[model samples]
Target chain A: MQGGWHRYKEGVMTGVALVAVGGVLQAVVGRIDWSRAAFPVNLLLLVLFLAGLGGMHTFRSKVGLFDRLGRLPASVSALGWVMGVTVLMGCIRQTPSHLLSDGVEVWPDFSRMLSSWSFVLLYVWMTVVLGLVILRRIYPFRWSKIPFLLHHVGLFVVMVTATLGSSDRKCLRMTLVLGELGRFAWSETDRRSVELPWTVELKEFVLDEYPPVLVLMDKETGKALPAEAPLRWVLEAGVEQGGFTDWDLKIVRSIPEAVPVAEEGRLDFVASRSVGAVYAVCLEAVHRKTKVRKEGWVSGGSFMFLGELLELDEHVCVAMMDREPRRFASRVVLNGGNGVRKEGVMEVNRPLEQDGWGMYLLGYDNAKGRWSDGCVVGLVYDPWQPYIYAGILFMMAGAVCLFVMAQSGKWKEETV
Target chain B: MSWDYFVYFAVVALAAWGAGALWAWRGRQVGWVYVFTLSGLAVFLGFILSLWVSLERPPMRTMGETRLWYSFFLPLGGLITYVRWKYKWILSFSFVLSLMFICINLLHPEMHSKTLMPALQSPWFAPHVIVYMFAYAMLGVAAVMAVCLLWLKKGNPGEREMTLCDNLVYVGLAFMTLGMLFGAVWAKEAWGHYWSWDPKETWAVATWFGYLIYVHYRLEVHSDCRKSLIILLVSFALLQMCWYGINYLPSARETSVHTYNLN
Candidate 1:
């Protein structure tokens, strides 16, 4: 029993030493500015570092103490405990308590909770345990073990990079006025003014909107029937509605920008102001049974008058509506102080990345246009992004490998 | 083609498929049910194809549009599971769930426009959503299996059903992992951050972890069937929250960038 206790103590010490070495190596790598290095050099350095670590882990695992620490029943139990707790905490963070409150109002603040020493210790412990398990299980790697190795290693690298490089992550919101040079940003968190390395001279901001669509609605039932074609095509085709009410609707004329005009006591459409210009469509609806016809001009946003209730039958009343601006996007240019520049369109789902920072089109003043001011952009500097991406590649490759192996019956003999 | 026509055709096909499922359940000629199931799937695919042609874009933008794919894939997943495990009741359960979604789409039709939002214009969108729906369907089947296993505890699952359940969980988990990875990559391209811990993403991770727990429990602990089934049921709840319930969360409703308004 004494000998067993001594062996266990030796294993614990070895595990702790290995973890310390890993932490130091990660810190060293985290301090390196890979962005400043040439692409080939960065690639070579990353490969060499990974190889060194892999070699060290393999060598350590051959030692009985290190190997035993990895295979310990307690380690698996601890991993399960940590994972379960982390998931619970994630769920709690998404709850109303954390979500409804602002950062200042949040009790036991989320960012604080994540950055706490205990949380960090737990995170590091889980990572170290998982790394040890992967290292021991994947040594003298067979084709079957590759998936496990890649996945666990990928996760380890992602966690290490994200945690160690937290201080390097910076996010700021900037309002780039049209044709204005903006060089300063005030960090709300730090409560300090930060001088930007490059001046962002906004060349232009273009916002493009989608074309409007017309639809016919039943006033009583509130059932809308959308037209399949544009105004011009609708005029040519002539839509016929046949369920319960037989009405044939035809577009008489369509104007892109128009205003209501009282011409000879009759409401007519005329070319109007460019801003807030309403799309007007002149429609003629004919009742097939009654042989009665009514004509009206329906302008977008003038739903009250534009939707004159046309009596189709004793039970049916119809009106016209227009659906406009399904989506919009912003195009901007980023001019640097070093005479370097990059131009890109920032639409939803597409952000601009430049020199370790990413500029996202958060929103714009609804009244603004290509020549207008006040476009909100979110600038994020996350140094760990490259590592996260690399981790994703590894995980994806691992998944594909496992899937292919499963399909090929390579895992048929495996139990877990 | 109008939405009315699409709805009418889909309803008729679903009714026929339902009748075929009933016939199969009643121990009639199984081939007829297979044919009807395939026919139903084909009809739904045809409707989706027609919409794609008319819209001039992949019909995967809105909730109604995605429901079309979900409705199709649910049965496809059920059929695969049923074939692999020879579980006769699996198709029936899947059919019912698919029918419910189809009804929801028909009853509350969202505005069907030809416009694709710029964010959804990515190449990753289709595959990401498609794989997720497939994974959801498979997980749904697994949950049903779990429920059956729990209810019929007196009767042990045959070796085949047990294996089928485990394999389904494995495949579903894998697909879920792939979906999360794809979304992360897409997020990096779109939002500039891979993991924002946004409510939706947080719930997604919770769901993933929930299933991971089940995987570990099944593989390492070798727990009893009842315990495993309970874990699967809990994981399924998490999956549901990740899929749609997240939208109702105050955080998601207020601040989530992922909430694609149901309307």
Candidate 2:
């Protein structure tokens, strides 16, 4: 019982120390903001956690430090756990279209790509400390298994590389309209355009743009339901037409205690996929008199009262996934590609690269339209490619060595 | 001369592979196979780089260059995997895979040669592909091991299979671990955080976790049935998604750092 107690204590202490080490390493790596209370407070917690773990483990002395080491490996294990699934980390922030649509709070934020100040500081910190710690060696030290060593070493290199990537790399974008192509994308902005390291003529850009997706809504009540798209929208209903479809009012289930309504008579549209009944929507008598335009077409999430102009500036576009609808765009894509040269509006998803830095297709100029052509660029600088390669090499070498050892009759003979 | 040159490179690679395979089939001489594999790599390394560099435009931005890069991945992978030990016909396999892929690309003349779009203009594209492919190749090696293990269980542990599988698994694990790191680093620079939980991201992490569990099991249980199966299953499935499954997801079209071709 006494021995068991000692072992438990050792285990707890080791776990605490590992966590502390990891947290400190994180801080040193710049994952925390030293200026803020969080980092400093976290540092205190690190100390306490470490002390707690240490005290918990070392309180009983039946087991030595060596035996308690593996528990700490769990921290590294956790680190691996966090890093393995990378898609969850949204580096780029995408603003949803203004047009009323379903909420998407769970969606990844693309804003991470910009690398905020806190991020940059943490990146620098992570780089320097990760480098030192990797080379210097931490608590559990042994080169018995090359794969094991390489794995840890590789992770360190990766961390450093990521930090370098933040500072060194840049991104940009250029657009093509159908058959258009170009040898270069764009520079920091429209005024400056950088040629590609290699030339590429656009062979083709398959629009594959599907027909407009539609959502049906009632005339009196704004209860929306899904419907076949590209329908002729009649906003105003005739006085006699209100019989078929009832206004699906989202009545508040609240009692007398609830806050009073802010305003009445104006119904906020509620979205639904399908409704049991269809409503008749007739054009308003006076509204039909002037056929200049109507703004009732909901596109790319932006509902525009349609104008009479046949060519709508903002076209509804969707980027879908898993049969579920994703984000929609209602911006005009001005393909500035002319003969051999190509250019266009850049969005976060779209980017152009020239020289070495990449340019994101931020947005386009509305006033100048396609005629006023320019590209916005995001630049990146990376110098630690060699280090990355080295890390990969070492890690791989270690793995090979370990694998060979496993096959060397030593491992099998002993284990079997 | 150009025709002769193309034929020469192709023949050289093929010959090296054939010889290596024959030897593996014979007695599984890893060293000889390594030498032959590397010889082929040495022969094609420059050619491959030259081919990549020779593009008059951002060849990678086009579907063809993507195919070409994938093709190059095998040889490049063979070159790396053989750094310490040679697996049976590993180099040859990479060469053949690359050649086959590139040849298929050639069949589609319309998709040939395109310049980088503003999005593809990012220098990250090359490294991203390179690192990811190497990771793929490494995993390919691992898959070979997994196949061999099954074969071994069937009492068909050909000497070549054992050596190759064992070596490849090691190499693959290393590459995967490194790939995970590189990806994170790249993302941190490209995005802010090191890891995200997108489907692809989820699968990548799952792959890593699978490997981690494998490694952990190796240290603790040392290759239990449950662990091995879990590891193998996760590795293969995640790999499949990484290669093809994720792309099919309609959500994949969403703008992401991991998004390819769309840029």
What residue runs in model 1 are displaced by over 4 Å at the alpha carbon? Answer: A1-107, A110-125, A185-193, A214-250, A259-269, A283-297, A301-333, A341-346, A367-374, A405-416, B15-34
Q: Write the per-residue lDDT of candidate 2 for residues A1-416, one digit (tens) a residue.
A: 24212423543453345445544554455233222433345446446644544553454256443222323233323333333323333222323322222344222212331122333333333233333333334335554534445655775665555443334433334543333444455532223566554433333221112222222333333333222111222122222221112121111221111111124752223223231111112121112333333222122221111111111113321111111111111122323335344433334444344343343334333332222233223344334446666765665565455545654544323221
By lDDT, the best candidate is 1
| TM-scores vs. true structure, each candidate | 0.76, 0.46
Tens digits of per-residue lDDT, candidate 1, A1-416, equal 24223433543454455435544544454322322443455556456645654664667646653444464432544444444545544445443322234564233333333533333444555566666777667646677677777767777787666655555567677777767777887653454567787777665565554555444454565655433211212211234222223567766776766767789997887787555456676767787788788777765444222433445555454444444333445556666768887777776667777787888776666543322455777778876678877888887776666555543445434424
Q: Model 1: C-alpha RMSD to truth?
A: 7.6
Q: Each prediction's Cα RMSD?
A: 7.6, 18.7
lDDT of all predictions, in order shown?
Answer: 0.64, 0.42
Query: Per-residue alpha-carbon lDDT of model 1 for B1-263, expressed as tens digits?
Result: 54557787788669766866676677678788788888888888888888888876688766677778888888888877656566778778888989988998887766556666556778898889888888888888888788878785468665556566677777787788888999999887776667777767867877876776666555543345666678789889977777777667643566677866423
Residues forming the 10-long window of minimal summed lDDT in candidate 1 chain B: B216-225
Tell me the DockQ of each model, to 2 decimals.
0.32, 0.06
